[model samples]
Target: MSEAVRPGAPRAVPYLRQPAFWIVIVLLVVGAVRIAQIAALFFGSFPLATLTAIVMFGLFAVPFWLLLAELDFLEREPAGLRVLAFAWGGLVATSVSIPGSTALDNLIAKLGSPDLAAEWGAALAGPTVEEIAKTLGVVAIVLIARTQVNSVLDGIVYGALVGLGFQIVENVVFAIGAVQQAGLGDRVQPVITTFLVRGFLAGIWSHTLFGALAGAGIGYLVVRRERSRRRRVAVAGLALFGAWASHSLWNSPILRDSFGDSVPAVLAILLLKGLPPLLLVLYLVRRAHDREAAYYVGILATVRDPGLITESELRALGSGSRRGAARRHAAASAGREAKLAVRRLQRAQAGLAVELSRGSDGAGACADRVRRHRATLAALGYPEAVEGARSWRHTASTVGTAALALAVLWVALSALGTA
Candidate 1:
């Protein structure tokens, strides 16, 4: 059966009809009410600290959100679905895991000893409970909108969103805990410290990365129809295990005192714990993105329309870097309008490919939209086909970004008592 949609063909059942949708909604509402009660308690006592944590972690989520948004640029997930994923992580997963992890930790103490639980409780209980809860968010997405998750990249994106949601909410909770632990009178200092340590220093390798790893497995399982069911399930389980193991190691007591409190020592510890998983997730993202890009570009390759997409444009469209280079080449040759035109042209072309893939008759409309942008580019004297090259500007931009990041790290570390 063709995957394409034709007139009178049945559409996906509305989300309202899906039992998973109601299940998710109920969980979200329950979580939200519980979290709100917690927030209220914090606000009644340490309003300033609570506000500070909320604002800081809210800001922290922006960059992660932007980067993840780019992960599936070819076929962006729906905005509503993305919000649902994040809410599941923040509200549902965190709410469930809070009590769940605590109970499991106590059980570990009973099974072993208090000392052993103190040392390994977080490493074991937290990841075991939290990963399962967060992975369920991706499963929920699949249950409600399976068509939206047609690619592995889609699963990664949703999983990352879920992780991001959990990370932000959990950081806020920790920040407030810091304030309470410090016995500070509604001060923001403790909140700032928590932000530096958790939000800045450890944020990169935390929940979001783990969620992506597990999400990759979920994506692979859902999309790889060619693979044997047992193989796909095994791969997905391995992925989830990888996520849990990484999270466990990160939270473990193994390196809590291994390195001294110096800035270099702390950074080294973080790198040791975080770098491997970071590299693995990056490789998966690149691999998934390339495959998705090739599928879409291949669809366009058959169009044989220079006005819509030329050979050079096809080459540029297949790569994130090359796509940016094409826009830059247009901007430098003409003006900012040329860059905008090129972006619109690229979006229209992508839309056309998507419509074609769906077996929809809207290909003509998509092609018309592409032609408008093509004309705009021509009028602006922007040749949208020039390949991008590494230039002095790129080098300067890279150096500048690194320097700025280093400066910020230094300030954060100094504030965090690592100096």
Candidate 2:
């Protein structure tokens, strides 16, 4: 017998329609307030404030944009959880760590040795406290939403966002303090230098790298169910230790001295010091990409039987350059809508690939992904466009590879300059 539906029971509403939801409203408010504050603080008084804000905003926003573009790699529930986790890290984690670490440092200083404080400041205080505080956000996120962090890359993205948030606030403080310390006459140069060095180079490794490293540990624990809990704890410990070590090296007095006395030498040391971890991150991301590609192969097989797409088309869609060509071809024949369809398909293919690689391969899961992909394609008004109509392209891989290579080269060159 069919049960009668209750007349007053609330139906679930789409996330966008739910404007009253606290999370959405809160995020919106925070974004507005932050942007307004940035304008008010930076735009008035200092001539360089506008430029500084632009550079800082670009650095902070780019990562978030990239992550959003690849959001299909994450399942919805997990993705939402991740966003919340990062927000928690940025808000609660930062709040706790700042005061906690400051109090601890003060206590250590009061224990009766100023020289000890200096030594500890470089070796321990900066790295140990900073990394832990930055990464505590990732840890909290992982603890609350363990299923969301599927790969080291996921950890890196989330951790980086958390770190980026911390860095933005920290940078503001440093810049304001610099203005106070040196006054207007000397402020601009130091601020510019700090922005160049810290905002770009150290900023990458600063909170973001530390949080990512710690997040890798959390992700490792979350992904592997066969390992003993103790082993998982060890993995998290090691990752955090690596984070601390990297942070310590960056903050070390040795590097600090090199910075002003010999700028080139300092750059060289930073590049050399930072390369291994960067390489490791690249390797992990590449593997994930490959795994995602393979996942699409499986899905393409199923969807093929339904006549929704062909195997040849699937193969062409696998590569980014090919997809771009397909879009161009469609644009020429079917107009802008066709081109839009191709773009949507491209994203869907990438997302599916990532999801498949991450073991989200049940029929329901696959169907949902395919449905979303189809909806996107339909929205572009080219729902019936053939996948293989255009040749494959390698543009995506080339661009990604080139960018990574450039980053590595920049680090290497910087390191050489230091030497």
Candidate 3:
């Protein structure tokens, strides 16, 4: 009659052990190979410029991952899916879009006029081509595993990864082409100017944003499976169309005339174009996070054992900063090891809460996991606040990040100056 000896939830299956994981890995490898071949061909034409394009854009790609991760913090998607999303964008989507868009442009030239194809083909073809190509990544993911996306936020994150992948690779191609247009002595200048323009100016509204919007549409279709199939399809279509229109607007030459060339003026126009969609996504994410947190927090009342999760622990999970402060609190009171132990405790509790919230039979198992972590924490003692100076490691990390950002800005400016 004792629940103390009851089993815990099954341990997470290793990614390598899953068949789907291996499939994703294989796909990623194939994509990487294709991209490498293309990059190699480009590099052979002009090595330094191509390499610089990859390196600077490599730096540019980091914030995309970091921002999307932050957006999807509470309910993280599987790492394999995330990798697949990025690969689809970087490798498959980009590879497909370039040739596909070019072919369409050529067709336009034949049908209309050469001038028309050169001037307006991208405005027509790019949105239709690139948005769909990037979106196919999300579709592939959903087809492979339908249950991975539970909310609009998940789709947005996945889409963002795919878009980011496409954007980085695309930027490198642009860089290479820009440098090629310049004189041999003046290549790096163009590459740096490209970095400043693409990475700093236009990047905020690039493929990732388009992908996020389209992915949210896909999320609606999958997550709302109970709805009439027609209704779901409509939502998905609308999301895709929004992405296409956004891309179309960006590509439209009208913005150049209406928005003007002033740096501040251009940024203000971009915000006007970009902010509403972003605000909607953020609002949805907030609602979803709240709904999930409420479910988990509500279940704690039924948990029956205070040792498994305290009220403070339940409250802490609501905000990342609170969670961090709790870890620091644990470290200050107990030892450094206790910090990790406390984190494990929080995670185990969250696991139990998830099982309960999902209506799964694994709640008993999850409870066992929570109890084990509780015992570990009990052995270490409870965390109490202790006043102390900030850790040197934390301070150093902050300083290092600031220095790196400054370095990047200086390089961009210097490169532009030399140009």
TM-score of each: 0.95, 0.66, 0.77
Q: 30-79 in candidate 1: lDDT tens per residue? A: 99999999999999999988998998899999989988887777777778
Q: What's the distance in Å from true for residue 126, model 1? A: 0.6
Q: State, as a TM-score between 0 and 1, how close model 2 is to the true structure.
A: 0.66
Weakest ten-residue segment in model 2 by summed lDDT: 1-10
Estimate the Cα RMSD of every predicted model relative to the unseen true structure.
Answer: 2.7, 8.5, 6.5
Alpha-carbon runs more than 4 Å astray in model 3: 1-33, 319-346, 357-419
Which parts of model 2 are misplaced by more than 4 Å?
Answer: 1-55, 63-82, 107-113, 119-123, 185-190, 255-263, 288-340, 349-419
lDDT score for residue 231 of model 2: 90
Clashing pairs in 3: 8-365, 9-365
Model 2, 1-419: lDDT tens digits are 00110011011324454433454346435644654565566656554755564466456656754653353232222445455545544554555555666766666688947776766665566666767766766665555444455554556667666666666656655665565566654246556545656675565556666666776676666655567899988987898898788776766665555556354565567676776666665565555434434445555556554334556557656544455567777787668777876666555554554444444444445456566666666666656445434333445667889789567647645653453
The best candidate by TM-score is 1
Judge candidate 3 against the unseen true structure and give its global Cα lDDT, from 0 to 1. Answer: 0.74
Give Cα-based local distance difference scores for all models.
0.87, 0.57, 0.74
Candidate 2 global lDDT: 0.57
Name the better of 1 and 2 by lDDT.
1
N/CA/C clash count, model 3: 2
